[model samples]
Target chain A: MGLSIPVGMAEVKASKTADDSLSALGLGSCIGVCVYDPRARVAGLAHVMLPDSAVIRATDRVVEGKFADTAVPALVQRVESLGARRADLRAAIAGGAQVFSFATSSPALAIGSRNAEAVVAALKTAGIPLLAQDCGGTVGRTVTLDVASGLVRVRVVGGEPVDLYRLG
Target chain B: MRDAGRPGATGSLSGDAGTGTRGILFMAFEAEGITELQLDALREVGNIGAGHAATALADLLGEEIDITVPTAGLRRTEEIAASPEAAEAMVVGVLFIVEGDAGGVIVYVFSEADARFLSDRLMGLEPGTTQQIDEMGCSMLGEVGNILSGSFVTALAEFTHLDFGLSPPNVAVDTLATILSEITVTAEALGELSLELDTHFVQQSGQLEGRFYYLMDRDSLGAILGALGMAG
Candidate 1:
């Protein structure tokens, strides 16, 4: 079974009675960040939709999954609550594509580029080591992380296929 | 139920003015066979739902948003596909399943870019998160469409005095060809007389998109128009 959170939403690492665990589904300009603490046998997933939340005005609510500013903190808090130690966590990120077919533009500030950068910064700040990542292409992806087996399956519409274990 | 004596009238009390017309009216980005009044009613209904959706996004983003429903008229799917706007924009579509023997399908299409914006914001994560655009995206989009369609469904049930249930909305994200192809399939079974409307949501970038279509059989269209007193 899989737990699918909307973009900008976070789910802390947990192991339930159910043997199979997975986090599935994500969409445009959104990134799914997965963290696994092998020591704790816990895995967490955060689906981010934007670069930062502070940029959002005080009245809007639809961008919960789009920003790094909001997503990182929320994720940290969730995983921490699950009794996962900060020192042992490792991360893998996927999705974040410039899906539009427009002429080549600067990638420096594009939302996709920015989101990946922000996620990396957040990981560094938290002192988490980078484990793996498959990002920054035009195609969309559905990443399924299986906590029981530590397998991350990446699927795309039209792109080179990758085995689930490749990301781990 | 109102004025059952009217020879052409169906006994249902739901009154929709300016609704009936057997012929199809074509335009860019939308097509359907329901009465004009039904289309109008549907647009108003979309306004309400878009407001709710915008609110959901605004709340998550911590900002204020406004979603407006524009004036709509009948049009063809090809016309909508050919429109320059359709080429570069993200389209958000919601299909409505209404209750009653005469009830049929209703469709809503929006700009593709606007759809990306909506998805980016609605999911409340990163703007450029999912580049794959696969079934998961469809499910995410379906959730988005559900909100807008829910509003229309609520309005229809109340105004038509009929109990209509909405099947989970099937959401699709794609380019002009994808949008046109899907609409073509739906139109074949539903018939065509698409009435179009524009809906603008006020937010960070002031997202705007067009919404339209009301699908129904001949008698249903006439009854709705006659009820609304818009029949000419």
Candidate 2:
């Protein structure tokens, strides 16, 4: 088995360590942002929990990857610092499922949808193309990005791991 | 039934407080950092709330129900970000919105097997018959969750003499980490951390069935603390 690094909530993992696979597990409403530079074979993964960081940033703790707005930009920079070209970066995302889908009035049910929207908008602002995505449903998902092969995979509970995206 | 005293039954919950955890740090949107005394107050809250809930459930079923001593987890957002709770563990839960003087979220969680067991028991079906919780199964879970969570809130209100309201419960089945992470961010908005007051329910044969996670926002924390005269 290859080295699989688990990306926890509000954390980003990126480097030229191409053999390592970065994974975000049990993503409920939280989103897993994966950015890859096929040319450099370098990839970065971020697990963002919230839509934006404007309010979180004003707090006593500033987690760069806690929100989509911050995590996207931060992932881009971290991947680039690993010798990946900014222009060649391609992004793919997964997670952000409305697991608590019943109550339409509750704001908790909206976070998943809001996070997906914020991540797409952030990628657009950063001039990164969101080549693929699997988001927004009633089930939780686990996303993994294999840096060496640049293949992204997603798995739901009681299900097999399926290829979300394959980048040769 | 370990009749360990309330608050003292929690061995490691507040044991870490007097350690180096005390610093200039504070929960977001709240004025004070968590201290040993404040944690004791929160534990007592869990104790009283769970105590009342246990009695209510026992009365409803007309049977014996035992509650494990309540335990509290004051997890830092950073620690949660490092390694979430019960990674890959799935749970059937009902999320409730806390309203009135103190507001936050409370999640009533149970294992899939436990939920299935309870659902079977509720519907008077034979054990080991439920493959998956269908509409009826889910409804049973919801109603029971509603009753259990409602009892807890009533206890809090009575203890603190504050008015409280509960929203209609939203039931879900998902990974524990995912559910907890979502609650962490959603319940408090940008909260640096929220306390989780966990208590388990034991019924016939002393088997554990369900547990409750009591999460509070900054204001909720302050309100309870203030009511207890532990506000700092």
Candidate 3:
């Protein structure tokens, strides 16, 4: 099923076989932070909307998949549910735009930036090396993760699509 | 001094309090840290956000949705700090984290019933489920928050020729007090502004409640307005 998932959302759709994991489109200023472990053939994606869970109310259910701090852990846990290991898993990050009106603040500290930093921090804290990153800037991005092939695509307007796995 | 629009036939909740020439105009004092221009920028930015949100809603629900342009209203922390409704209000807060070029989050809140109304329609569920609240329901709710908030932030970038980084939206279901407290404590970090918009759904009772908090110093707002060629 070719489905388009909007921002601040994630879906774990699977195909009949181990080769049919799903993919989501466009992630900008929003992170398309994904995790995959070859051994488990498992992959997970989160379109995070904030940096940390601290900003949310304790009773909110949407908190799990909403922030980078929490969502990253949740994605890792999800992949692990299918038998993926943190040590063997490779991570990729993309998209975070300063989507609001102009300001003098450093874009590096904006929510998008914070999310990227938080994701990186969370992965490192979990002892996982971030294999690749496509973060920052002023554009919206669409990300696709083909769980079966372990192929990931990051697309943005005015630029060529990029392969997150192959990038140095 | 007040210029009230013709009051809608539907009586105000206060009934007796809204009959004057000025309808119901609740003006919170100008935000000490927020400037008029920033509020305007936020308003225009909201239009863009709402437009994108409308499109997403149309796509998700397979129906036509229209959102009226946003109007800016700067309310004091005290004014909005109070719960507007007596019943337990189901509010979803979408915080668009902006970094690199800008900083802040757009806090969009809606009544739980309204959220379910939009969620049911978006998920293609039948009517009468508008009052249902669950995790599945929250996912749909998160989508609307993400689209509307993200688009609104994106509009700011377009108008100011600035780039922004965004964090994912923080979705929650809570009471007005809880939601207000969540925003209140962050007062030091944000230049808050409120924009209450009127949104229309194809076959559902319309929804209301929208607000934005730009985490920037007061001066930055003037600069943004100057960029838009508007007065501070």
> Which candidate ranks first by lDDT, i.e. highest?
2
Better of 2 and 3 by DockQ: 2
lDDT of candidate 3 over B113-232, digit per residue (tens):
667667666777786566766777766666676675566556667767766676565555554444443443233234332333333223223443344344443344555566677644
Tens-place lDDT digits, model 3, residues A51-156? 6766544543354665666777777777777777777888777876543323345443365577688878877877767887888875556676666666778766
lDDT of 2 by residue, B26-140 (tens): 1121224667667556656765676667766666655666665444566555454313456677778788877888887777777788778877777778988888877777778
**Sort order, TM-score high to low:** 2, 3, 1
Q: List where candidate 3 sits over 4 angstroms from the true fold.
A: A1-21, A24-26, A57-62, A104-109, A158-160, A166-168, B1-232
RMSD of 1: 18.5
Model 3 reaches what TM-score against the true structure? 0.44
Q: What is the C-alpha RMSD of each candidate to the true structure, in Å?
A: 18.5, 6.2, 16.0
Tell me the deviation in Å of residue A7 in model 3.
Answer: 6.9
For candidate 2, the iRMS in Å is 2.7
Q: Which one wins on DockQ? A: 2
Candidate with more favorable, higher lDDT: 1 or 3 = 3
| lDDT of all predictions | 0.50, 0.74, 0.52
- What pairs collide in candidate 2? none
Cα deviation at B208, candidate 3, in Å, is 22
> Could you tell which candidate, 1 or 2, scores higher by DockQ?
2
Cα lDDT, model 2, residue A117? 95
